[model samples]
Target: MKAMRLEAIGKLFVREVEKPVPGSEDLLVRVEACGICGTDRHLLHGEFPSTPPVTLGHEFCGIVEVVGEAVKGFKPGMRITGDPNISCGLCPQCQAGRVNLCANLKAIGISRDGGFADYVIVPQKQAFDIPLTLPPEHGAFCEPLACCLHCIDMARIKAGSSVIVLGGGVIGLLTVQLARLAGATTVILSTRQESKRRLAEELGATASFDPSEDDPIGGLAGLKGLLPGGADVVIECAGVRETVMQAPKLAKSGGTVVILGVLAQGEKVEIEPFDILFRELRLIGSFINPHTHRRAADLVASGKINVEKLISRKITLDEAPETIRNPARAGEIKVLVMAGT
Candidate 1:
């Protein structure tokens, strides 16, 4: 089997490896398609915590080639998407139903071997069944869409409310659709990339802005601006210091701000505590997907979210190492690695 392995910090390579066997409660998934995420780049640079010498793909979906004897409600040839984040059921957070914050959490791609190869071992609990009828690449979106769902849940978007998505990446674009579905009448997206901004508008953003061309905060949040005040909710999906810092400022007083982006570890941004205190704003940091994977799968299967348009490119496993080692190409939305390619 060919696998893209992260040998260490700043080192990633495609190497031939022995095929893996599933555990009693696991399923051996023949990798169909796996999306190259920003976290993969972060992992390569040690920006995110990940165990090296492991396969480096988390956003994956595939056909089950072999099912463990202990696994139920699933069979060989069934299509599935792996949740990746494995939480210890006995952890305090898990007991409290906050599984994403589990004290003992091991993600498949980050810790164990993952789906960047011919086969990946997925525990039964971490696998969600999706329709075999959908395109193989659609399944790979479940993980990221699940994370965006969590952010929407936290945003609590209401009918006729306004939302500002602070990035035009896949997360931001998916979020724009979700915000509209959540009943936000006015949805705006801000990104420096003109192409992404245009795509965002097509994907249901009421409007899109290029932050590089104008002052995003003032242009959208000022008294004479789009909202005439500020958005009811501001979700930061750019995962950069500038966007994170601008999130709260873009929100109306007493509104909410959700940070759905993954900033590198040890990164810092200076925010005004006084503004938050005075406005009584709710600032939240949304981590990985919790109980939303199934809903994401359902959304994808139902064809409600436009996963097809978000796919920028599909490459073979041989091309993954170089792709992950470098930054995402300008205006690239999502890149998938096709196992059989």
Candidate 2:
């Protein structure tokens, strides 16, 4: 087996290693495809929760090369994707069904070996079986879409409401489509990249803006002459402090703001208390996927979310290191690691 491990901060190594053996409660997946995520970048730079000298690929899917004795309903050739957050199920938060807030939780790639190798092992509890006929690459999207689905679930989006998604990355694009399906009458995407903005428009955003080129908030006001009534819901997916602060400003009175982006540790932003006191806005912080991983697989299988457009680059495992260093390598949007290909 060839594995890509993060030896330490700012370093990754692809080396030969022995394939793992599946335990009774585990399944050994033959890696087919994996997606390089923002978390991976953060982990590489020591910004996220990952121990040094670990195998560091997470967003992925593969064929079940072997299944443990206790793992049933899955065969040697089953295709699946799931990396359940390992948590104390008996903890207060887990008992309250808020397992994302569990006192002790460790993610698969961040806590242990992940899918950036020829084979990876995971508990059957975290694994969701996908139809073997589904392309492995599509299976790779299941995890990310699952996380986005969790956020969408938190939003409780109303039909015909307006939504402004601030960011045009993979998560932002998914948020746009999900908001549209939730019945948002007008979906707006704010991004500085022309290509991303164009793609958002093509996907479903009624409008797109380049903030680097102009004031997005002001532009909308210019058209409507009334600040466009702000958005009924402002979902900040950019994960930057400035954009997070702007979420409140972009949201209308009595509206909700869902923070979906990951911020750095010790990061802070300023928000006026008067605005919250007078306008009555709801602020929510969304975490990782909990029970929605399977639902994400269903959505992808049903062809509800178009992940194909977001996939801009697909490379093999050997190129993972360079791809990790350069975000735009090969014009990457969602750069995938095709392990077996």
Candidate 3:
């Protein structure tokens, strides 16, 4: 089997490795497609915490080749999406139903061998079934969509509510659709790329803004801006310093700001505590997909979310190391690594 191994920080390569076997409760998944995430780049640059000498792909979907004896309700030839985050059931956070914040958490691709290979092992508890009739590439979206679902849940969007999504990447674009589905009437997206801005509007953003061209904080949240008094909810999805800092200011006095982006581990950004205090704003940080993977799979299977448009490129595993090494191409949304390609 072949895998893209992160030998160490700043070291990544396509290496031939022995195939993995499933445990009593695990399934051996033949990697079909895995999406390259910003976190992959972060992991490569040591901007994020990850176990080196491991495969680096978390957003993945595949076909079941071998099922463990202890696994039930799943069989060979089934298509499924894997939830990478595994929380210790005995942890305080898990007992309180806050699994994402569990004291002991190990994620696939980050801590273990992942889907950027010919085969990856997934525990029965981590796999969600998706229809075989759907395009394999779309299955790769389930993981990211699940994370976005958590962000939407945190945003608490309501009917007629206004939302401002910072960054027009896959996360931001998916969020725009989810916000609309969540009953937000005014959905806006802000990004520097003109192509992404246009795509965001096509994907249900009521409007899009280019921060590089105009001041986003003023153009979108100003008194005379798009949303007169600011948006009801502002989601920072760019995972950059500027967008993170602008999130709170883009919200109305009583609006909510959800940080759904993943900045570098030690990256710092200054925010105004007094402003939050005065406005009574709700500022939150949304982590990875906690309990939303199943719903994300269902949404993808049902064809409600347009995962197709979000796919910018599809490449072979051989191309993955370089793709993860370099920055995303101009206006690129999501790139998937097709195993058999």
Which parts of model 1 have CA positions greater than 4 angstroms off? 221-225
**Candidate 2 structure quality by residue, lDDT tens digits, 1-341:** 89999989999889898899999989999889999988888888887877778787788888888889999788888888866477779889999998888888877778788988888998888898888778778888888787788887887788888888998888899899988988888888988888898899899999888777756667767864534678888888878898998888888899889999887756899999899778999888889888888888998887888888999888888998888876664324688999655
The TM-score of candidate 2 is 0.95
* Poorest stretch of ten by lDDT in candidate 1: 216-225
C-alpha TM-score for every candidate:
0.98, 0.95, 0.98
Cα lDDT, all candidates = 0.92, 0.84, 0.93
Instruction: State model 2's lDDT.
Output: 0.84
Name the Cα RMSD for model 2.
1.7
Positional deviation of 115 in candidate 1, in angstroms?
Answer: 0.9
In candidate 3, position 241 carries an lDDT of: 98
Which parts of model 3 have CA positions greater than 4 angstroms off?
220-225
Of candidate 3, the 10-residue stretch with the lowest lDDT total is 216-225
lDDT of 1 by residue, 1-341 (tens): 88899999988898999999898999999999999999999999999998898898999999999988999989999999999999998988999999999999999999999989989999999999998899999999999999999999988999999999999889999999999999999999999999998999888998888777767667655533687678899999999999999888888899999999999999999999999999999999899899999999999999999989999999999998888877899989999999777
Sorted on lDDT, best first, the list reads 3, 1, 2
Backbone clashes in model 3, listed as residue pairs: none
Q: Candidate 2: minimum summed lDDT over ten consecutive residues — where?
A: 324-333
Candidate 1 residue 144 C-alpha distance from true site, Å: 0.2
